[model samples]
Target: MEINKFIDHTILKATATEADIIELCKEAREYEFFSVCVNSGYVPLAKKQLSNSKVKVCAVVGFPLGAMSTEAKVFEAEQALKDGAEEIDMVINIGELKSKNLKKVEDEIAAIKNVIGDKVLKVIIETCYLTPQEIVIASELAVNAKADYVKTSTGFGTDGAKMENIKLMKKAVNGSAKIKASGGIKNLDTALSYIEAGVERIGTSSGVSIVKELKG
Candidate 1:
């Protein structure tokens, strides 16, 4: 199934160093994974490292926490794209969503998408913090905001992606947008399971091992 193409080689830890990103790009180039996901600050370095390769650069905005102001998220996304990020994975404001501020949640996503026009926008709904109904709501909100993908979690959350959540998201998006299952996906079996459930992307730090497992 060309599983490597479905993977987004990721390293978003706060403790990640220059060497770590370099090695990440190196591995991404070697393994020929789809893209390398990093913090906005590392977009330039990742872009530089990945130059001349087909592997794209994806930058995270609002990161593991989506509490930042929408303007802040927009600026982060703009700067990441200016620095060569080909795709943006943004976290939605969980607090606002829980407050039932649906407009705010949808507006925040739409605002970011407005700036990144045509550059891929994947909304990270941080599924761990939401209820089943909330997951569906967030997924629909992402679709309403015209996001390219609806992502499950941030991995830093208390929990990660689950099959039930994937099904909910699938029904929620209704094919208006694609789905990305991130967090806690660390093996070939788990990744394959998500793909089997219809996720278009797999965001994980275990892309190396997962691809190796598939190759072997």
Candidate 2:
């Protein structure tokens, strides 16, 4: 498999600097990653840096915490698209889901997807914080909301993607939406494993290293 095409090279830390984003875009272009995922604040920088390259710029909305209001997330997603983001990886309203407020979760996701239009929207359910049943529920909600992908984690949560969670997510979506397995996927083997398990995208900061390992 051409793993680079499946990888979304990511750097979402609060302290990620301009130089960091520049290097990220540079590496993404050189490595030919599917996209360079970054914070909304760096969307314009990444867009400018990767303008001449095929590497797309992906921005995060609601980020590690999906506690923001739907209107706020919609505004953030809209601004990101205007700033040149081609894809959005948004965190789900975990609190609402846990509280059994399915409508809130579904509406929030649908609201963001509604604004993004044809652009990709990957809803992050932050699987580590939820039970297996919650993971299934969130995945189903993403499918109903018309999200492009159901993502496993934010890479800032208690844990990253797990194979079991990916399996559950895939089954829940039932091909209605694609799958993105992010967080703690740090090696070529792990990345391939997720692909074999039916995930369509892999979000990780270890893209360069994983590709290097593949080359070796």
Candidate 3:
């Protein structure tokens, strides 16, 4: 399969520089990745670098920690879109979800979606921090909130996406939304395994390496 299309070439490290984002867009164009995921601060640069390319600019909202207020997340998402982000990967309020405040979690996602309109919204459930039941509940909440995808991990969590979590997310979304398996997808085999497990997207910093492996 042409796996590059399924990849969201990502670089979300705390120390990422402007040069790093430029190179990311360059590599994304070269590899024809589906998108280049970056921090919100670099959205304009990524958008400029990728202006004439099919590779989209995706911005992360609430980032590694989703403890921010819903207003903050919504504003972040709206500004990212204005800065030219075509897709948004937002972290949910994990604390609320754990507290069984499902409505709060659902409203937070819905509020951001309301501002973005037709722009794509991917909810990062950070599966590593959740139990099986929590994963299911989060997935359902995302679906109900009109999220386009239920993403696994932040790649900043204790662990990234696992096959088991992918399966659970898939069953939970039940076709209500797509699945994006990020974190720990370092090679071709693991990437494909997530796809086979029903993930429609792969978020990783190793997209170039994975494609190189595919070529070899």
Candidate 4:
């Protein structure tokens, strides 16, 4: 199924040097991945490297933790776009949802979506933190809030995306939102399996490895 197009080559380490991101963009260019997902700070550099390539630039917002205020998230998203990011994968506020403050959660996402209009927004629910019901709720909220995609994890959390979670997300979303399963997907088997389970996008640092696995 042309797995490279499904992959979003990721490198989100706090200690990642500029050379690291440059190497990442080179790998993405070589592999022809759909995009290179990086921190907002690296968007311009990655953009420079990926110039004239079909590969897109995706930046994370509110990142590993979704506890930031809506204003903060919007500002981060704006800065990322200004830095040449074409897509955004934002983490939803889990604590707010768990606390029955769903309005706050929805409004936050909606606000970001409004500001970033037509620029893809992948809402990271961080599946590991939510119950099955919460997953469904989050999916519905994301869909209703007009998010383009409902994603799985942040890779910094306890666990990465699971097939079961993807399946649940697929059913919960009911085609209203696309699914992007991120984190811990290290091999071809898991990557393909997530696609089989209805993930439209994949977020992982192991993009090249998985493609090699696919070649095998």
RMSD of each: 0.5, 0.6, 0.6, 0.8
The digit string of per-residue lDDT tens for model 1 on 1-216 reads: 799999999999999999999999999999999999999999999999999999999999998899999999999999999999999999999999999999999999999999999999999999889999999999999999999999999999999999999999999999999999999999999999999999999999999999889889
Pull out the clashing pairs in model 3. Answer: none
Clashing residue pairs in candidate 1 are none
Model 4 Cα shift for residue 35 (angstroms) = 0.3
In candidate 1, residue 122 scores what lDDT? Answer: 98
The number of clashing residue pairs in each candidate reads: 0, 0, 0, 0
Better of 1 and 2 by lDDT: 1
Q: What is the C-alpha lDDT profile of model 3 across 1-216, one tens digit per residue?
A: 899999999999999999999999999999999999999999999999998899999999999899999989999999999999999999999999999999999999999999999999999999989999999999999999999999999999899998888899899999999999999889999998888888899999999999999999
- Ten-residue region with minimum lDDT total, candidate 2: 63-72
Q: Give the per-residue Cα lDDT of candidate 4 at 123.
A: 98
Clashing pairs in 4: none
Give Cα-based local distance difference scores for all models.
0.97, 0.95, 0.95, 0.93
lDDT by residue (1-216, candidate 4, tens digit) is 799999999999999999999999999999999999998889999999999999999999998899988899999999999988999999999999999898889999999999899999999999999999999899989998999999999999999998888888889889989999998989898888888877899999999999988888
Q: Give the best candidate by lDDT.
A: 1
Writing each residue's lDDT as its tens digit, candidate 2 over 1-216 gives 689999999999989999999999999999999999999999999999998899999999998899988999999999999999999999998999999999989999999999999999999999999998999999999999999999999999999999999999999999899999999999998999999998889999999999999999
